[model samples]
Target: MEKQTSANKPHIMTIPYPYQGHMNPMLQFSKRLASKGVQITILATNDVKTSKLAHTSSINIEYISYEIEQGDEIPKSVAAGLGYVNHKVLKRVPGIIEKHKASGSPIKVIVYDSLIHGALELAHKLGLRGASLFTQTCAVCSVYYHVQRGSLALPLEGHTVSLPSIPVLEIEDLPSLVQAHDRLYPGLLEVIKKQFVDLEKAEWIFFNVFDKLEEEIAKWLSSQWPIKTIGPSIPSMFLDKRLPDDRDYGLNLFKPDAEACIKWLSAKATGSVVYVSFGSVANLAQNHMDELAWGLLNSNINFLWVVRETEQNKLPGNFKAEASEKGLVVSWCPQLEVLAHKAVGSFMTHCGWNSTLEALSLGMPMLVMPQWADQTTNAKYVVDVWQTGVWVKARDKEIFTREDITNRIKDVMDGAKGEELRVNAIKWKEQAVEAMSEGGSSDKNIDEFISKVISTTT
Candidate 1:
């Protein structure tokens, strides 16, 4: 084991593209890096500033807020796409960087989000060290690379393309998210390719995935470019193993909702209740929510759902009704504590990286309902590789159809395969913990990664 040291005590600026998933991982990465002597500054847009999140700790690292000057000339959609609000914000960063250098907080390196391609050009122009923090997994990165090289094209509109190299996935039963049609966003892919052209500008590339989880593909990635596998980056610094492990608190964020729903699980027996949550950001249409409402009603299983503001639709006003006495519905609750609870036998989730990791970490079986973005990719791993979940495709878009809604949830909760998935989910959970422990793959990569990126700051 390596002792903490001050070798990496050079100033590092982390600029994440504006988004929850991207921002969260970079913050956690910098937090851990700062703990080991790295001086990190998280750069956020002035409009979508990270001012409140700046660590006010006694650590030597500093966080600076710089605004991309806002202007009225650009349309709302165009500004988001261009990564600028007003021309001022784009024009000001270089000046800000120069000022920082003048102030003696000389940036030894700049860590930019891969999605922000323009930042690469700006970094080179300013003469600073730089790296690209890819918030997606190595597999997704490989798909982007292979697609760029012409080895693959997104499957034709109606067909599926087979990726034989991906382990645990068969050609005949290809995971829905990995399938050809309805894959990759047409507009976003174009933006990504242009940004990737700036790959040569980066000093290093870091991915949000682990060695044990994607070893083969990660190795393949390293062959083409300087790559680091350091992921499953949940703000896991929060977990306390010293506490009693009764389990089933469910999945959640920095705050724990342990008391909020653990009581609901108390009355239910193990392997009897199903939990459904699609994460904080994703929302299905009202009809879909209604369909899901009735689906839960028909499943003959006791279920708990956490519906957010966006998922609002007129379901039976007291949808949880007599079941309200039996079922629980809340706009939001602590997720991890619920997942860890004793009564949560299964989870129907949105397949986000954090959720997937929590499910795998807790050894809880899942029913994957990927909404969009990396969720599709996450679902593939859950249902295909981990053998811990079932993928529920949104085949019938009319989410109002009671029959489709009820049957999908039913398939996830009570199929003959659910029990097998439960056993495997637990085994993977242990493996996940081991991967983060001493000499674990995640621990090794975190050490190795700092050396490759922030360590050279001086």
Candidate 2:
């Protein structure tokens, strides 16, 4: 066998969009590639603080500086961030590559977030391979692809949508961006549309999903592109346990109230607590917050809800005191740990892809309350297709009410339907493990990716 040296190992640089959700899966994928003996470098804007995660892994994270005066305005900041990445950062990648090459570890490939439009072109310009890492599911990506290709016209004509390999979707079930293009931030809408620009030119396209989860859509999309499903992208401890001490993702934007949550949950009986969160980004309107708070109270079930400090003021007056006996409210909790705990009966979530995958991986059913973006689509699959959970249905002419939330929580906890949801959830959890196990679908795809990089680079 040839001796492996720093110079001979294939180096790959990962550039994720500067968001917690985007950066996490890319970092997990880096860990997977590193386990296979490939050299991994994760590039981020200087504003992102990933040192805690970086110190825990063998992978290297390099931060590049680009000045942007961000403020309370989100859309403005997004526009500025995109500008910094496309123009300022793209211009500097070559120097970074040369610096790495001089250090005896040259970047042979650039694996970038799919939403970044210029990464593939820049990779080809520098004579390196490019792989687009899509953090969304095949179903959501297919919808976006059709929209970009002009097959699904904007200002959609009807109340229903039918697409290849996707279930017939109601107009409201579509992604919020697609449903109301004019209402959302224009900058983000444009960035999402650019996900398919020159997409076919990439050397590889990877989705953070398992094949069986979206079998028909994966089959159709794979035929057109060099697509691979190499995910659930969760830590090893929760899935296949192939990697050592991989219990957490190691990067959390918010510190978790771990001890309090675990101790409280430990006191409860198995399958007795409701876990509620809206993820990191989604900020519910005051009305929605009030509804959710009272709804959990009305469910008459033991619950733990993560309400960010910013959103706590929106809660009804004396809410925490009233529900103190039955509920625990915290800013954040270690999500995977909470999900894996026996006390957690079901998740009341916004159905973000990462959260959905985490719930599925842990055999926890969901009461999906989709807020925006691809969440609506994920909620649909969770309820209609996967049979893993029930949706939080709203009353007529109302978005969602306290009564609706109370009913959904009951359906997932004490109702007969909860049994069916648990059965399906356990089955999906086992399938998730199989996908990451040795010789499994995602594992095989990852091995193939590593081999191709080595063969081409060597």
Candidate 3:
């Protein structure tokens, strides 16, 4: 496990926003690049010293630390309100760049998360090649590129957009925030226009979603920009090491009670339990949670819910009394393993690309409730393109009672329509296996992209 250092090795450095969502993908990319003989340096904000992700020490790459904190006056454009990609993440880059440039090992290229504007600029200022890392689907990334070209940008109001392929689906069939933040659509536009002082300086765009999975969007991305498709990077890296599928602290931040969840699942018959998780970011109001709880109850289905503490909207506590016995609730379970468990019939999800891809890979059908931008799109694909799931719209803040929530859950979980989703879900699962195996589309795309990376000259 010695550092592979030589003049000929490609000296590639990476910086990911300290959140698990950003860090996980960067680690996967670093691992893959290390496996391919690159001399890698992965820079973490000084906060990583306290974060659990810093525990993984790889000899192939050097860990350079940058400190991120509240004191550094950060711009509001990048503020996510919480987590690593906040203002603190951006303020650390100037120091990180200065340290890397002064160090004897000159950085040849930097791959950084798109949310971090300062680091990418500093890398360009140092005459280094820089790439933006996007963990979402390529369609979303292409939309960013389009927005940059002024193809889409309206006054920030309550306007809805009709994407090219989406059908005339109701809001209930889309995955989006109940409050409708239009987060990715608007926030990313601001990042391009205001946050990154140097937009044209980027060398490449790296996506963690593969090409075949996003055929039309990937094609559009490649036509306009130097784009690389290399994902469900998590699964590729998970199976990259000749190891069995399991959970690690790298992805699951909360202490996983996988055994507990799986044991409960084991007690149920096949396709009897519904696995519910709304992803890392999204949070529901207490009234919404009560309705959802009632819905699961009315459906009379065995359900496992990953309840986040943020859903305490003054009503969750009261609703809990009704749902106490009918559901198994844990803060977090090993998501991948739980989804693959024999009894997991369907998933209730936020439709984040990572979660959507994982559910798709596991052959689990979905009941999509999206909280942000691409999730809405992902939800549409789940129900429309794939024909393997149902999507729920965010209900009005006051009128959405428990009875309504219970009925929707019953529709997707216990009714005749739910059966159709299951049949198609199993079919998509077969395609996912084909895509992951040797000569599979995912494998082939990675090979093609890696070949381009190897053949390209600085």
Best by TM-score: 2
Measured against the true structure, the TM-scores of the candidates, in listed sequence, are 0.80, 0.95, 0.79
Summarize candidate 3's per-residue lDDT along 352-424 as a digit string, tens digits: 8878877876778888777665676677778777787775544344345556556667776678998888787
Clashes of each: 26, 0, 7
Q: After superposition on all CA atoms, how large is the RMSD of candidate 3?
A: 4.8
lDDT per residue as tens, model 1, 1-458: 34345544466677765556666667666655665556666665443323335333512333233343355344345325454421333465676677678987677677777776676677777787777888876766665655555565655333444443565433223323334333433344555545468586577788866677777888877777787765655545333231122222211232334466777788889767788888767868766777678777777788888876445444567676756755787767667767877888889888877677777877889887777666777787777787888755553342236665456556656777877897898787777676655567766766776665544554
Q: How big is the positional error of residue 157 in model 3, measured in Å on the Cα after superposition?
A: 9.9
Report model 1's TM-score to 2 decimal places.
Answer: 0.80
Which lDDT tens digits does candidate 2 get at residues 1-458?
A: 12236656789999887677887899889888887778888887664464467575578878776564365223255655675566655876888899998987789999999877798999999899999999999999999888888998988888899999889999888898898864666666667878888888999999999988899999999887989999999999999997876888887878899999999999999999999998999999988889899999998999999999998889899999999999999999999999999999999999999999999888999998888999999999999999898878751345788998899899889989999999999999999999999999999998888878888888
Q: Where does candidate 1 stray beyond 4 Å?
A: 1-8, 45-70, 76-82, 85-92, 154-158, 167-186, 237-259, 262-272, 393-416, 452-458
Candidate 2 colliding pairs, count? 0
Instruction: Supply candidate 3's per-residue lDDT for 182.
Output: 46
The runs of at least 3 residues in candidate 2 whose Cα sits more than 4 Å from the true structure, single-residue gaps closed, are 1-7, 45-51, 65-81, 395-397
- RMSD of each candidate relative to the true structure: 4.9, 2.5, 4.8
Query: How well does model 1 score by local distance difference test?
Result: 0.64
